[model samples]
Target: MDAANLEFIIQMLEQDTDLKEKIKDQVTEFDKKTRTMAGLLNKIHSTPTAQLPPLLDSVQPILASCTDITAVIAQLVPANQFWRWKDMWCNSLRSAVFSATLIEYLRSGTLLTLPQVGGILGIHPEWADRFTLAAEDYLHGLISLVNELSRLAVNSVTLGNYEEPLRISAFVKDLFAGFAMLNLKNDLLRRRYDSLKYDIKKIEEVVYDVSLRKLAPTPAK
Candidate 1:
């Protein structure tokens, strides 16, 4: 990405305040639920082994009712097959892991500083050292999906035709005309992905800074 392109993309990202709010809302909702789950799990751990069975029995139904994973996934996937639901599922799992990690951080008050995301994400220190890699994976997946959808759209315009540029041009124009509706959806989806990845970076930075400050040695008298 050239500097100009990068700058433009950054500006585009900043322009969508409402989308950022929605992303924040989504993260907040997930965080709240994860915290609740963490507290419950902590309580479960604190309970005696002998008493655990009955306690878990009572909690199982409630936990199951709290959120329907399948339903949520269904709601997230677009109807089009080219949109890559599999990548969404993969990223969702990663997000869940991050959420769980955050919940653990809150419950234990452990200093999960920077230089530690690699370990959290199961990446060795020698390999790579930031949450941005995870975000890159997400962005690449979404970009591939969008490119595939664009290709599919192009293919639909040229289907079963040869040596007829005029006919293809007319049909392609019509196809694009219909595809115009996707413009806003594409912008929104891209913005959401970018904002989310950016937010992940911010979270990592904040946690790291806080952890380091907390872990710093006391000053000499």
Candidate 2:
């Protein structure tokens, strides 16, 4: 082919502003849905501990709808720009995981693993690898979860629940240890990981205060 023809072919194959815009619109929907869920999460966190169960229950349908929106986004993304939009969807995915874990922590005070995060986003766990950004892997979202849990640890005590803080302390410490095993190359993730040290200390302090006061639940003899 002539040089002009070759250039035109490359442009046709590579230049995809129109599709990119459509994908952006879809991502905007995902963003909106996830943000709504985040708002509900804020409410859940702020609610009195006794009221948290009902708040969580009310948000369950909203979270499911957000996951549906995420699924729609995955289907709407054009194959040509799949990789191009990965970064755009990162926040939405992170929010979905946050919502999922918030529910789990409310119901059982359990740590939601990366695999379960996928289920929240309505995607299989394996897809987590595909969506990992070049600079920061998707697992960085776990740091966001840990961050919220730290705050929750403090709030749980104010709400008169010491057990949740203890559970959160154990979960955050375990998660931090797991992250330590990774040789993270991303500066953003590394910085986030470094900050986790302080968060872990904060939760530890909360647990320590409770134990020192003899307010913590007694262990079985």
Candidate 3:
């Protein structure tokens, strides 16, 4: 082949401009869905824990929409570029994770396992025939929740709930430990992992104050 002809072929393959724009358009929709969810879940932060689950009602419809968008994105991007385009939905994925975790946290004062997180994202983790996304993306979302829960731990103490802060401290500690177990290769995820330390410290401080004050509600002794 002539030099100019070979170079043109390389540029055509490399550009894949149509596919890039298609991915971009879908990602824009994903971003909107994420912001919508983030806004809805934001209400959860201020909401009394008792009333939290009901607030999840508003997010249910959007979760369905986000799930559909995820499936479409999976089909649009080639396998080679899957993870790259998938990264675009991390915010939405995390928001879904946050919503589920927050609902679980407020309702039961516990964190959901990654499989459970998959349930929130409407995908199966069994690696079966139809699994469209990875559990790792949703797990990253939980990291964001750890940050949210740290503030909640402090706020819980302010709200006259010593027990919740104690729970938050324990939960954040566990999440911190879990993040440490993974040999995370993603630079952005690793950086976020670094921030967990500060959240851990914040929760610890709250726990310490709660215990020191003897304000932490203990079973009748």
Which candidate should be chosen as best, given TM-score against the real structure? 2
What is the C-alpha local distance difference test score of candidate 2? 0.74
Model 3 local distance difference test score:
0.73
Give me the candidate number with maximum lDDT.
2
TM-score of each: 0.27, 0.82, 0.79
Candidate that beats the other on TM-score, 2 or 3, i.e. the better one:
2
Write model 1 residue lDDT over 12-115, tens digit each, in one string. 77754544454345445545554454456445324543454565455344334324442333334334431333443344334444433333332342323333
User: Model 3: C-alpha RMSD to truth?
Assistant: 3.6
- Using TM-score as the measure, name the better of candidate 1 and candidate 3: 3
Query: What local lDDT score does residue 58 receive in model 2, on the 0 to 100 scale?
Result: 78
For residues 24-132, write the lDDT of model 3, one tens digit per residue: 7877887787778778877755677677667877776786776676566667766556555555655666777776677677667787887776766666443233234
How high is the CA lDDT of each candidate model? Answer: 0.38, 0.74, 0.73
Stretches > 4 Å off in candidate 3: 1-15, 124-132, 219-221
Clashing pairs in 3: none
Q: lDDT tens string, model 2, 1-221?
A: 99999999888766566656766787688778778877878775567787888888877887777656656565656544547678777777677776787788778867776656666656743343334323243466678788888888898788778787888887788888888999987687788899999999999999999988988895566
**Candidate structures ordered by lDDT, highest first:** 2, 3, 1
